[model samples]
Target chain A: MNSASPPDLLTRSGSGLLNWLHGWRAVFRFAGVAIVESLTPRTYNSATRSVVLKQIYFTAWQILPRFTLFAALLSYVLIQIVVDTARNFGLADYALEATIRLLVLEILPLMTALFVALRSGAATGTEVVLMNIHNEIQAIEAAGVDPNRFEFIPRVIGGAISVLALTAVTSSIALLIAYVVVYGPQYWNLPDFARVVAHIFDLPTLTILWAKVLAFGLAVTVIPITEALAAPKKLFFAPIAVLRGMVRLFFVLMLIEVLSLALKYI
Target chain B: MRLLEETPDAALISDSLPLRANLSVLENVAIVLQYRRNMNYDAAADRAWALLGRLGQTDSAFKRDPDLGSEQRFAAKLARALILPQPIILIERPGLLLPDTHYPAFLDAALTAVEDLFEQCWIVDYTWNEPLYAPR
Candidate 1:
C-alpha cells in the first residue's frame, strides 16, 4: 500500500545505532535539566506542583495497594524458598542474611522500578508523544511557558518519587513477610532479626542500596520521556517511542542491578 | 507566531482549550503565573483570581476544564494566556471556538480584551477573507 525508500542494510543499521545513541544522549541531558530544575526552589510554583501532584496520584497512590500485595506475595514465596533451601543444606544461619540481602538490598528496588516503569513510565512516554504530535509543547512555548518546568520536570519528579515510595513500602512489606516466614511470627526473635538486619544493612551496603534505588527511580521516568521526545511528531511514531522507551528502561534497570552487584561482590 | 521567539511577552490561545484538563481553573491559571512569573502559590492564586475577575470569569476559578462549556473554556484559556505580561498574542482558530451566532460577538469581545492588554495580536482564521481582529 505504501512505497518508500528502502535504504541499504548498512546505512539502515548505522542510522539505527546512531538514533539509539542519540536517544540516550537526550535522556541524560533531560535528566540533567530535571535534576537542576527540581532542585531550584523557584521551579515549584502552583502549576508545576499541580503537575507533580497529579503525577504522584496516578503513579504512586493509585497503584499502592495492589503493588504492595503483589510484592508481599512474591516476598513470601522467595523467602520460603531461600529458607527451605538453606535448611536442607544445613546452612540455616546464612538463610536470614541471604534473604535480607537479596530481598531488601537488590530485588525489591529493581522490582519496584520495573513495575513502575511498565505502568507509569510507558504511560508517560505515550502521553508525551501524544502531546508532541498535537504540538502541545510548541503551543505551551508559544505562550511563553517552559514545557520542561511545567510538564516534563514534574513528570520526572513524580516518577522518581513514586518509584522511591513504592520501593520503600514494598521492601518493608517484604521484610515483614520474610520475618514471619522465617521466625514464625514470634517476638523472641526480634533481637536476632535486628542483628541480622544491622549486619546485612551496614554503611556501604545501605549507601549502595540508596544510590541504586535513586538511580532506578530516575531512570524509570527519565528514559521514557526522553525517548518520547526523540520521536518524530507523527502519529505513527507513538508506538515506536513507547517501544524504545520500554527497551531502554529494561536495559537501564538491569544495568543498575548489575553495577550494584558488581560493586558489592566483584 | 514569529514574534513569539524574539519576545517573551507573547501568548497563544488554541482551539483545543490548551489548559490541562485535569487541573482546576485556579490551578490552570496559577501554574502559569508561578512557572512563568515566578510567583509563589498563594501569590499565584491571588494574581490568578484577580486575572479571572478581570476576564469576568471569577466564578469558574475552581471548576475543572471538562466541566466548562465551550465559551467558558475559551475564557479560561484566554485567562491563562493573559496571566503573563505579554504584549503580543496569537490566537489560533478563533472562529472555530463558537457557533456562527456566537463567534462574531466573541471575537469582538476578545479583540477588545487583546487591544487593552497587548499592542499587537494575530488572530489566525482561515475562513476570513479580511483580517477580522487586525491591529485596531
Candidate 2:
C-alpha cells in the first residue's frame, strides 16, 4: 500500500472539511424549507391538520402533567438553592433578579426543548428514517403529494408549537414558584415581585427570550428530521441517524444558551 | 411525470410497501388530492370518499395501514394514484399485481369508471411483450 504525499493528505483533509460543511448546509436548507412551507396557508389541509394535531398530542398533551410537575420541582429547588446561597452571602437583594434570570431567561426554555426533543424528536427522526427506508416518501411523491407540506412541515410546526406551549406553561409555573419561595405567597410583595420581574424581563431581554425559545423549538424537531432525511435509506442507519440528530440537537441547544447568555451579560 | 426524477408529480402504488404507512387510508388519499389537486380539506375528503366508494374501498377508508389487508391497502394506494389529476399515470411492474390476463380488462373498467381523466397510463413490467405499454 502506498502512503499519501503532503498534497494528497491536504486534499483529503480539504475534501473532508467540504463534506462536513455540505452536511451542515443541507440541514439549514431543509430547515429553511420547513419554515417557509409551514408558514404557507396552503400547506395546512385536513391531512396535514391531522398530522399536526397528532404531533401536538404526542409532543405536548401526553406529557403536560408530568412535565410541568417536574419543571416546577426543579425550579423550586434551583430557586431555593439560589435564594439561600444569596442570603448567606449577604446578596439577598439580588436573589429575585438572579432567580428570574436563571429560570425564565435560561433554564426553562432549554429544559422544555430538551424534554420535547428526547421524546418527540427521536420518534420523528425514527419515523422519517423508516419512511425513507421503506420508500414511503417516494410513494407520497408518486401520489403527487408534497411531502414537505404534508409530512415534514406539519411535524416541524407541531414540534415548534409544542415547545412554545410547554415553555410557556413551565416558565409561568416557575415564576409563580419563585414568588412563593421568595415572598412567602403573601399579596404584600406583589409590587416588589412585579418590579423585579419587569426589570429582568425588559424589552430586549423579552425579545431575546422569545427568539431563543423559538430557535430551540425549531432546532429540536427540524434537526432530527433533517438528520433522518440525510441518512442512508437502510434499517441499520436509523439508529445512527437518531444518535447523530440527538447529538447535534444538544450542541445546538447549548450554543443557543451560550449565545443568549452572551447577549444578556457579555 | 418524469419517472426517473427525485420528486415526481405522479403517484406511485408499490406492491412491496404501503404508500404511506404512517397515515390512515383517508389521510393517504386526501393528502394526494389536497396537495396535488389543490383542493381544500372538505373537498379533498369528499373526493377521497367518492373515489374510495367508487373503488369499493369505503370500508377501509378510515383504517390505518397496519389494520388493512393486502388487497385493501392496494385499493387505497390505487385511489391515491387516481386522485392525482396528472396526464400520465405510471404503474410499475403490473405483472406483479395485474397479471397479463387481467391487465386490459382492469384498465378498461377503471379507465371507463373515471371517465378517462388521464390521457396516458404507462404500465411498466419487464414480462410484458414491450418495455412500456400505453392503453388507448
Candidate 3:
C-alpha cells in the first residue's frame, strides 16, 4: 500500500538534505552577521545599549540569587563525593585537583549554559517567532529601524556577557565550596587551594574555558533566533520553532563542552 | 499600502504593524527616535512624552500593548510613526485597529492634533468604509 518508485523517494530525500543544508547555512550566516554588527561601533547607540541593558537584567541579574544557591548546593554535594571517595581510596592528595577540574573546568560552565538556554533562550525564540508571525520585524524595518542592529545584535551581546558573568560567579562559588569541602572551613589551607587552582587553571585551560563559555553563550541566543527566523510566519509554528531551537542549542552546547574537553585533555 | 511600500520615508500604521508587546508604549514610540536619530534615552523619552502629551495619552506612556485601549494604542502607533523624520503617514484600515469606536472621528482628531509633524497623511480602506470618511 505504501509502495513508491525509487526515483521519487530519491528526489524527496535529496530535497530534504538540501533543506537541512540550507537551514544550517542560514544559521551560520546570521551568526556571522550578528557578530559583525555587534563589533561595529556604529551599531552601538542609545537604543541598542538600552536593549542590551534590559536583556542582561532579565537574563543574568534576575535569576542570579536562586541560580547561585542551586549551583552552590550541587557543587558542595559533588565535591563532597569526590573528596570522600578519594580519601577512602587513600589518594586524598589528588582530590582537590580532581574536584577542581571536574567542577570548575567542566560542570559549572555547562550548567550555566544549560540554565540560560532553557530560561532566556526559549523565551527569546518564542518572542521572535511571535514577532515574525505578527510581521513586527517587517514593520520595524519599514519604520526605518534595522531590526538586526537595534534589536537582535544587542540581545546577542547581552546574552554572551550574561553567560560569562554567570559562569564566573557560579564557578567562583563552586571553587569556594570545593575548598571548604576539602579543607574543612579554615584559612590555613588557602595556600594549598591556591596551588591547586593555579595548577589546574594554567594559561591554556583558562583560555579554552573562556572561549568555550563565550561560544556557548553565543550559541544559545543565536541558534534560537536563527531557527525562529527560519520558521514560517504562522501562529502554530511558534512552538515548533522554539522546540527546534532548544534542541539545536542543547546539541551545540554539548558540542562546545566536548570540544573544550578535547582541547584541554586530549 | 503597495503603492507606498517603495517610498523611502513612508511610515505605515496598520494591524500588521503592531506595537512590540514586550515594550512599553513609551518605548514603542521612543525607539524610533533612539534608533533613527540616535537620541539618548532621556531625550527620546522626553520627546515621546511630548508626543503622547499632544494626544492626551501621557497616562498610558508606561503601559504595554495588551493594557492599552484602542484609542490609546492608535495614539501610540501614530506617535511612533510621526517620530520618523518627515514621515509620510500611511494609515491602513483604521477600523481594524479601532473596531469599537468611530475611527473616523478618532483619526481626524489624532491627525489634526499632530498635523504639523508629518509631511502628509494617507488612509487606505475598503470601499464599504468610504462613508466613514465622508463629510459628517
Candidate 4:
C-alpha cells in the first residue's frame, strides 16, 4: 500500500538535511581515498589503465556520435534564438559571444553530466552499492587487490575524460553550427569564430571550464559510489542509495556550473 | 524443499571504510569475521549468503562480490565479469537515492530479468539486495 501522502515538512526537511550532509561527507571521503590511493604505484597498474580506458570507452565513446548530434541540434536552436533575439534588440555584436557562453560554458557539459547520470551514474551507483552490500570491494582488497586503483579510480578517470572528450567534440561542432547560422556557409566567419573562442575561452575561462568539467565528471561517479557505500546492508535501501546519489550528483553538477561561472565572470 | 534448495538472490556492496570512520568495511564485519566461530571475513560472508536461503530470504547483499556486473557493456567485458564472485553476499536496500539516473528502466529490467531466479527478493538494508536467487 502507498502512503498516499508525502511526509510532513519536518520529517522531509530532517531527512533532506541528513541526506545532504551524509552524501557530501561521502564525496569528500571518497575523494580523499582516491587521492591517497592514486599516490600508490599499484593504483596505476596495467589493470587500472585497462579499466579506465574501458570505462571511458563505454561511457564516452559509445555515445560520442549520438551526443554530438544532440548537442548540435540544441546548439543550433539556441544560437538561432539568441542571434535572432539579439538582433531584435540590436545587440548583434554580442550574439556570438552570448551563444558561445551559453552553449560552451554552460549547457553542453551539464547536458553531458545528465546523460552520464542517466546512463552510467545510475549503473555505477547500483553497481557500487551492490558491491558494498555484497562485500565485493572488500574481497578484492583481501585478495591483495587495491580496489581503488583496480576498480574505482579508473571510473573517476574515465568519467573526467568522458566529460572533457564530449565537451571538446560538441563545443567544436556547435561553434561551426553557430557560424553557419550567423554568417551563412562561408569562410568569412572563421576569424570571428576563432576570435570568440579566444576571447570567451581566454586562459581563465578555459582553465575554469576544464576544471569544472572535470569536477562535474568526478562528482558524477564519486557521489554515487559514496552513497552506494552508505547504503545499509539491507535490500530496501539500494534504490534509496541510488536516489541519494542522483540528487547529490545533480546538486554537484549545478554547483560546479555556478562555481565556474563565478570564477569566469565574477 | 525443492524451492528452498535453489540458490538465493542477493546483492553485495563492497567499499573501503573511510579511514576517519571507525568502521572500515572490514572492521564493520569484525564481529562476524574475527570473533564468530573463527571464520575470516570471506568465510563468514560466504556462510552468510548460504544462510539467506534458509531464512526464506532470496536475494540480499553480502559483503562479498558474487557474480559481479558492470554499469554497461564494454570491450573485454567477458574477462572482467569472469573474475571471482564476491566473497560476502549481504542484503541491502534497492538503490533509489544512490546514483542511478536510469532508475525505473535499468533496474526494472534487471529485476524483471532475475525474477525467475529467486523465490523471494526484498530490500532491507543500506545498498544491498538480491533479485536472482534460484527458485527451490
DockQ top scorer: 3
DockQ (Cα-based) for each candidate: 0.48, 0.47, 0.79, 0.03
Local distance difference test scores for all models: 0.82, 0.81, 0.89, 0.63
Please give the clash total of every predicted structure, in order.
1, 4, 0, 95
Global fold similarity of model 2 (TM-score):
0.87
Clashing pairs in 1: A47-B31
**RMSD of model 4, in Å?**
14.9
**On residues A169-238, what C-alpha lDDT tens digit does candidate 1 reach at each position?**
9888888887888899788999999998988888999899988988898998899888888888889999
Q: Across residues B15-130, which tens digit of lDDT does each residue of candidate 4 receive?
A: 22111121222222332333323445466445444433323222323222222122221101111211223322232333432244443344344445434434444433432344
Compute fnat per model.
0.50, 0.61, 0.85, 0.00
User: Candidate 4 local accuracy as lDDT?
Assistant: 0.63
- Candidate 1 docking DockQ: 0.48
The better-scoring model by TM-score among 2 and 4 is 2
Report the C-alpha lDDT of model 3 over A102-126, residue by residue, as the tens digit. Answer: 9988999999999999999999999
Residue range B1-136, candidate 3, lDDT tens digits:
4645576667788888888888899998889889988999889999999999999899999999889999999999888888754557778889999989988888888888898888777777898888778431
Better of 2 and 3 by lDDT: 3
In angstroms and one decimal each, the interface RMSD of every candidate reads 2.9, 2.6, 1.1, 14.3
Query: For model 4 chain A, where is the 10-residue window of minimal lDDT?
Result: A136-145
Worst 10 residues of 3 chain A by lDDT: A136-145
How far does residue B55 in candidate 2 sit from its true spot (Å)? 1.9
Please identify which of the two predictions, 3 or 4, would achieve the higher TM-score against the true structure.
3
Model 1 earns a TM-score of 0.86
